[model samples]
Target: MPKESSQRGPTADRLHRVVVIVDENSNPFELGCTTEVFGLRRPELGRELYDFRLCSPAPLTSMRDGFFTLTGVAGLEAADSADTLIVPNRPDVEVPRRPAVLDAVRRAHARGARLVGLCSGAFTLAEAGVLDGRRATAHWQWADAFRSRFPAVRLEPDVLFVDDGDILTAAGSSAALDLGLHLVRRDHGAEVANSVSRRLVFAAHRDGGQRQFVERPLPDLPDESLGPVLAWAQERLDAPLTVADLAARAAVSPATLHRRFRAQLGTTPLAWLRGERMALACRLIERGESRMDVVARRSGLGTAANLRLAMRRERGVSPSAYRRRFGPRVA
Candidate 1:
């Protein structure tokens, strides 16, 4: 976590009211994914989570699904009252750089509210100018287009998500879940996030970039040992890997391994392992690996029923649907 916020203030204890701005040509997946992570109540985890409002810029914004429409529910003012604002995916026509919406996002950000853009939601933030020179990400398919359209934004296409402290972003679709879980862990604690992840059955964490797992895999060599560890762990994910088990292969003591990971990866051994396993499940699902039993054993997540339970809560996709379309891409 960042310790450099000089403008320290009182921490509010109210359940975070996260308002998501729904658009006409919005991705119901991304919008719902946002709510799943933030809006849903997690009492078993024992933390104040959020109050979600699926708001639209207008009083009765419309949503399209081939040839149907659903009421947008809340208005932009609802978004204005949000503790955190989410833009799922913009219309297929053109990503809007709405002055009104942009002003709301900026004001919310300035007031210390976290703003998130999932997939093309990045388009909204970039246009609002909040992403100027700041590290951000979008779906791999749109990486080139996003860069061409908004050069001021430093678009990192390979990572699952970018956590620039107050402002955060993720690649399209399911990577949104990764960012959401990251926030949960950041705000609450490892135990809480882990529990939430368990309920969602989503990868509590991921391994290498979505690139390595994508159809067009990236090279393996890098200036880091974590990748090797990640790959090694994936192959033997079924094995109960201890910190010492991982540390020995890395040629470092358990304490040293923990220290190095904290400095570089910002997490501990067990946490990283869980993330890697979850990521593998995501990959398998994308590659038409739908059998929960196979995905669970292969990804080292556990069982088919467990996978179903987890996906329903966190990833917000059925095993069947996940196999159909991958949300996050590591291009």
Candidate 2:
């Protein structure tokens, strides 16, 4: 989807409404993910991005594994007014979702509101029949069960998340944050998403296609974290950086660096670098940089043609089209 500007200082009705359904046995982690991503006040942006709220079928809801009892939120009708409705996650995937919850999801989809499923929340979506013939993901541990239960749904079980136009799904716990940040990036542009990510101290961009897990044995020697190298590369994205350069900076061979990147970030170094450059390009575009060549140069994409290719390849839109969608408005 093309990026959309977070209309700064918009009226109440203009703000995007994000409502989360806190169902019985729902997980709190994803609830916190939604709250942190869409519900919080962005004083840093000098505005709030969404008119966020929580809703439930009943006044008292039990959290996953009996963590706690949640109460005093809006009713399920709150979801009807939402621009995005986040379905709840529960650990027990075998158990069926409430009929009312499924109906709410169906209605939300019928009304053209965005639907999100985090972790086992995919089960809710599948149970609701909205995921039929749709690409979706759930925690890898339940891949067999999900495939067995929803034979019609295209389940991409290994990735972190799947964004199928109006509907999105994330695999497992931490991926909820990945999908949430993705939504922010989709709705408000890269700069705003990065700001929110920095505030949360989380990685701003994790490709939804990245693997959910890496099965690597523990290192015999002391583990060399990739944090410093990644930070260094991010600070100098405009420079001509190669795998050798990154390996040299990290005091490791290119092969070793590749393994570490896969284990830690679940993506290749080059892929990560390209993603960062594209994000920088988006930020530049969003800041009203009119010249495509300038955006390409500063973002280390080399040329305007390469910029357009990258934008179209990764963002599914041309640079000019993205700029038109998300660029600053004239007073």
Candidate 3:
């Protein structure tokens, strides 16, 4: 378990009303993610943090997986009074959204309600035009199609999620849970979010901009794949590892290592190494380590200057700022 932060405080005073918009053939896992985060009662707090409601275009709807049907759902008008409006994954993104749904989403944003999209639900937000000129993300599988349809939105497909202030967009099914916990962390502080995470058996916080876990096609010959070599490199992140070193560890020539890395990880050896080092630095920062030099050395990033440059280039934030947002706070 991680240490509790001392800077815990309510982000807002009043109970927040959250409304989830369900469309026909909605994804149950996405809806359940929202419900699990906002709908549950937290007696530990002595008061509810969110008043969660489910509203759909219709009162009854069947889910996409065809295993469950939802009933007692409120109409679109229910969203009119919500503090946050969430859209879960739909059956398709290419299909046009209902005008009524678009209008409600636009109106909610115009009235200052926070808007969220889980997975392909980002398509609906894009259709509503609320995502225009804003940074957002969706499941990586739909990256090309999403870009083709909505060229105006700056889509970052690699990320777990994107929090562009009032509009939050999550990448895929599991990313929805990350975004949901993020909302809790944003509204009720880390202590409460961590408590909720423990109950849910989920990671309390994953930086939204962290890269998605992409699946790669591996070679049939296990020896040809670089999995073991990658693991070895990970264990030696603090060491001055090189392409030649990696090649030696894998018992392959540097040229062969390059080919295998491209085929397996879709990146160069040095680039992948940098990404791993940056990820390690982020974890160290989140754990409340304040010494930049120590963090850089531990992560094999070399110096405080290099860490700052890498963080800025990759994560768009300074080390101190990242720590302030994620590190354990002292009283």
Q: Using Cα atoms with residue i matched to residue i, what is each candidate's TM-score against the true structure?
A: 0.62, 0.91, 0.67
Model 2: weakest 10-residue lDDT segment is: 1-10
| lDDT pick, better of 2 and 3 | 2
lDDT of 2 by residue, 181-291 (tens): 898888778888899999999988999999999756577858678989999999999999999999999999999999999988889999999999999999999999999
Q: lDDT for model 2, please.
A: 0.88
Which candidate order results from sorting by lDDT in descending order? 2, 3, 1
Can you rank all candidates by TM-score, best first?
A: 2, 3, 1
TM-score of 1: 0.62
RMSD of each: 14.2, 3.1, 6.6
Global CA lDDT computed for model 1:
0.69
* Colliding residue pairs in candidate 1: 200-310, 201-310, 205-275, 211-330
lDDT of 1 by residue, 84-138 (tens): 6786466462646557777888877767677778878888888777788888888
lDDT at residue 205 of model 1 (Cα atoms): 62
* Residue-level error in angstroms, candidate 1, position 319: 38
Model 3 per-residue lDDT tens digits across residues 269-306:
88888877887887788777899999999999999999
In candidate 2, position 188 carries an lDDT of 75
